[model samples]
Target: MKRIFEELAFVNVFAPQSVEKTTDKTTAFVDTSGAGEVAFLVSTAALGAGKKVTVTVMGSDQSTGASAKAIGDAVEFSDSVGTDPQTIVVSYQVDPANPRYIGLKFQHDGDAAVLCGVAVAGRSLYLPAANGWTVAK
Candidate 1:
């Protein structure tokens, strides 16, 4: 029998780009301060849509709470799982200015965290940064 392994998924948000002063070619990570969405690349072999993904965000400040609106605006893959040859990506509206730590929890079926993944605190989301908040996932 083949052993199944837990995986670390990479989550990123593609901030909009601007027209270069010298060139017209577009770019990635340009002007990240503007409005955008938080996105993640998931492994279909591991998870799928409507799979009850729990996203958690944390930061360094006590006054700041995870942006619920941001997570709510996320868009899920339609036919991504087991279909798209490329990595599955999901997007959620979020504020770039805020320090953010995001975690996405999917149904693990029966995979034990000790065996395949690291254990995450249920509510210990925020962390201390220089002086700001960030995604804790």
Candidate 2:
């Protein structure tokens, strides 16, 4: 099988203003429309002790509005080694019927802000077509 990769979103360094709050914390959304498989990757440069980060995959039927739903369980991480870079990765399969666009939601907790970078990527595999050409190439 041939594999194709696409970058959904990237953040060199996280900032407070780049996120939207849902209830008590902040969230960053990444659009992964028409993706068959997705991988959410998060990296922290200097996460302080007691700090926590959660990455959740969200989806919606329309491009905008309140029809969004959480696709899967949120993947969470806590600072184990202070001042050390932490990385988190989560993978999911997209449903074709619903959730036309996928959203990556980042949730932050604790007093100290998380100094981190986040990237979302999608992977698709295709077999060779009748003409001996793959979908990616």
Name the best candidate (by lDDT): 2
**What's the CA RMSD of model 1 in angstroms?**
18.0
> lDDT of all predictions, in order shown?
0.30, 0.57
TM-score of each: 0.27, 0.61
- Which residue pairs come into collision in candidate 2? none
| lDDT (C-alpha) at residue 58 in model 1 | 30
Candidate 1 worst ten-residue window by lDDT: 21-30
3-120 in candidate 2: lDDT tens per residue?
3323333432234233322223323444455456766666656556766777766777655524667777877778776667677876767667656665566766645544545556
Residue-level error in angstroms, candidate 1, position 95:
3.5
Off by over 4 Å in 2: 1-34, 64-66, 127-137
